[model samples]
Target: MKISARSVAATLRDPGAWRIVLLHGEDAGLIRERATQAAQVITPDLDDPFRVAILGRDAHDRMVEECTALSLVGGRRVVWVREGRDGLTGLVKECLATRTDTLLIIEAPGLESRSKLRALLEKAKDCAVIACYPEEGRALEASIRQMLSEQGVQIDPDALSWFAERASPDRAATRAEVEKLFLFAGQGGRLTHEDVQACIGDAASVSLEDAAFAAMVGDRTGADLAIERAMNTDRMNPIGAARALLSHIHRLRRVRLAMDAGQGRAEAMSALWPQVFFKRTEAFGRAVAIWSADALMQAAVWTQQLELACKQTGSPDIVLCKRHVARLAAQARIMARQR
Candidate 1:
């Protein structure tokens, strides 16, 4: 039967009927959690090493064969297929058709509406599919509030919105952020916006935020420092950082254009095609003050040029990234002064 993630928690509370289940989501944390719970149900004794068999596409056939084989030393066995994709979908279908008593758990990236694998799971009697999408806005806020309440912690509405605004795009990151907030609020104290800001936001996020803010406010030195810190940390990929910065610049350009057409800041910001963050409000405001409509238009041109350079350059990823950040910093400073 088909089920949602919310249902998975309750259905997994008693997994006696589910022999072959698939847990797939963009949220690695949720997928891993559900997989662990299903594995535990199949094997209550955690010490038994043979109770769990984790495999990938390459060993799909062998793992399914082993699961179907007679149990040698354990009452139940679980075969978890990680990163299973289209290549192994046929193998999964074959295994499910054969009806193995051992539980089969498959995890993959999110599937679309017409996905064959998704359809297969939906149609199967003993199989199930779970989808995970990025959480934001009200959905994210509600999740944070629920998590905090469950932990016996209380947070005001403003603080809850703050946490949600800064939360990561995926469930794993969100869960980690909430857990950090809970720990920070320890001993029955109400969590405040400051507390959320202090503990929930990581150095990497802060650095990225700073880089974006610096670019918006036309601060070459600050932008350079932020990019340098981000690169030196080695936690974020250079290519990923460039893409994020480009996205920010694009958002700013859009907002600027709308305002140029006689729209107010609130309307222009609201009319932005891409999503904007509350954290960006101050930086965006600074940018509007320091740059004219023409300046922002030119900034957009520079942004595109940097994008092309980064893409075309044969240099190493790090070097390419550094060059782009430096160029952007210089451009931002020039534009800020022009305004």
Candidate 2:
């Protein structure tokens, strides 16, 4: 009933008795993709209204009927419920009890661990539940590689990491970027580092990464320039840069904490999740060695507060973000001297 992350793909390919499948997660694109895959297993033509019924949250009162109905084409029907919520628990339960030939796919984006529908699907032998969380680090890179591989697009290993660095954390955004790359590369075309930099890289995201890494390592000049480019070029929001900085700080903290726990710096860095982007590896290593765990923790707090300030309506978000970056750079300078 409950599909492990490892078994999700395999199960979706051959969901023997699972008449109702629930896909829930923060990754909306992943949910849509898995649901589509599962539905196609039962009915290939999702566009065919006779074999497929797409129901929104408000119009789901007839979900039970849709699930029990047979397709006009004489095969199994597919009932896809979009924007699922707790209101459909009873209907879903009813569908399970009725033993219908229709395969039900539910798209629930924000279902909580205690959600009744999620719970029911997990417990019911006739149902399957799959959770999709955003991928990060190596996993994110692997996902990009797989997407390209499936599209018959080839990318050099270094270029793949560079592209992954700019890839948005949100799956939908990442998918859009990947699709654009697909068009740029064409079928069976190869992508090199320069090719990806030219087509996929933009100033905002790259500058954001630059600002984050530079701020952590006492590169005040580098941090200043990168922050300005990120906020001014490509209409990058200060809040977004603040988040990127926060993420980098957290990553440094994780590695620093590991070093504090008796692991060598090289080993700890090697074990970083979503390993350091190839271009940033040296800078990241320097930042990790320069900042102690406590300093990194304090910097994280500063970055977090900066993010909260950026959310204030009509606030000078860019100014607020810059001040924090300056403070972090100053702290990094002091740490460097002491080291």
Candidate 3:
């Protein structure tokens, strides 16, 4: 039936139950990735000539023929259909209804809501349809963490957040960035917040992350400089900046409340998405100590107000943004002193 990207791994545990499996989505990389994983589940060696039959270009007819044939090497056979399209619908239907031994796996590009192949797989009792939409926010972050954790690599929560924020929607690109971080961290070594900044900051968005972090920690001068660089050099809109800032404040509020509810500092911070930066770990500890959950709640409200102001008529948006950020910086300084 219908499955989700999150549940693909679990479904692969007993893939023999499904006669045909369709993997389709807007993110081609994730489609290929899941297809490969499913292939491995069917057969240990991907290049095994007899057990696996990989359909080449314009080989839909051959795919149908292969699916119905008995395996020469004698074990469970895998008939993989790559670069799948609507043209293969008839053949897929024939193979699914008739073939018993061969596990049919199809990898296709984005499918419409009414796609014949997708619809057929969804309706079939012995078939599965996996939707691979591009992941965002905490879902993407959790996926990144799980992948890295599988490799025995532990990313610092702050560094993880920073890297996740900059990660591309393409699963291939996301995996490449994580691989780079793994290489930089070396075997069994932990990846820190500084490692993320050092390895993943070529893009201009680093300045925005810097501004957000600076604003959170009461570094007035650093926040102002980062804001200027982000706006003037990167041409980021005031509204965009305000929204990003608000998101960070909201996370801080969540972390602060977690700590207030008896969670340890490290435990609370690690639970947040776009986690507290590793280099800022000690500073974050200080922040949570100095500012109560109520203060962070108030900051979120103020930041939301600032975002609305930037979108309002007749307001000098840039000046309003600057003043609002300055106020946040001032509040941080006050809280730090009172501690």
Candidate 4:
């Protein structure tokens, strides 16, 4: 069975129907949170050695043993596995073939559609797969409202929207911001748009956001400084910075394609999320014209390759990332002049 982010809580309310639960997605923080929730739902005391077992992908033998073991305390048993990957395929198959009632919760990175492990987990009648895609727009709005409401804090509609738009894609970041607001609101006091800007709109994230925009618009010096501030001041990871740029390139690709198909500049710009801040609207319009859909697509591919190289080779990440940013900006400048 497939469970979405919106349904994770409800599904866990009655998790017994499935023998194994797979929470995998791009949002690593959300994946970890959901896995913890599932594990807690199965075994109330997650730290109880007799009732719960936590294992890594390399501990296949231990995981298999724990999955089939009976609880020493005669209650519920949970086998929680972290970093699920191709290596756990055999152990997962063996465990699922058995009739053990021990609840298994696996947390893995985003799996490809053809991934053997994902295929096995999804095909199993006893498994539940939860895909943790990044939350945005209405889903994000709902999450913010639900969390704040539960804390007995009410927020202005405009304030809620502003907060959601600025919150990091990571669920942990979003939760932290909301919790901060809850403490700030105190008692029955309501939060306003200004409160969100003053309290939760992160300057570091804004710097990174600006850096990405700067890179896309061919502002070499501005991009360099923004990247520097984001890394040194904000402490953003190089990999994360690359991913951010890739996401922007993707949005640019889509909007450029739409404009090529005759969509107006306003129409193309209006289609994006967190809608481009008013201050950056003009720069954004220039960016859309700076790169064609094909160029943006190539940039996306190159960004992904750079990310992989950084991860696999243990290279000096910031240096390589900065070089890539500079190249992208130069390319955009050339493209802009050609137009």
The top-ranked prediction according to lDDT is: 2
- Note the Cα lDDT for every prediction shown: 0.71, 0.86, 0.81, 0.83
Residues 179-276, candidate 4: write the lDDT tens digits.
89988988777999878778876666667778888888999999988888877854577888888889878878778998999999889888887666
Structural similarity to truth (TM-score) of each candidate: 0.66, 0.82, 0.66, 0.64
lDDT of 3 by residue, 145-238 (tens): 9888877889877677777777888898899888887787777878877777788665346677778778778888998888878878554888
Indicate the worst ten consecutive residues by lDDT in candidate 4. Answer: 200-209
Best by TM-score: 2
**Candidate 2 residue lDDT tens string, 60-123:** 9989998888777798888899999987898887888896788888999988889999888888
Q: Counting only residues 3 or more apart in sequence or on different chains, how many pairs clash (N, Cα, C under 3 Å) in candidate 3?
A: 2
Report each candidate's C-alpha RMSD, comma-separated, in the order given: 5.3, 3.3, 5.6, 6.7
For candidate 2, give the lDDT. Answer: 0.86
Better of 3 and 4 by lDDT: 4
Query: Which residue pairs collide, candidate 1?
Result: none
Q: Tell me the spans in candidate 1 whose CA falls farther than 4 Å from its real position.
A: 1-19, 25-27, 38-103, 108-119, 133-149, 153-181, 187-200, 219-232, 236-241, 260-263, 267-280, 289-294, 310-339
Q: Of the pair 2 and 3, which is ahead by TM-score?
A: 2
Clashing pairs in 2: 137-274
Winner by TM-score between candidate 3 and candidate 1: 3
**Sort by lDDT, top down from the best:** 2, 4, 3, 1
lDDT, candidate 1, residue 24? Answer: 67
Query: What is the Å distance of residue 67 in model 4 from its true position?
Result: 0.8
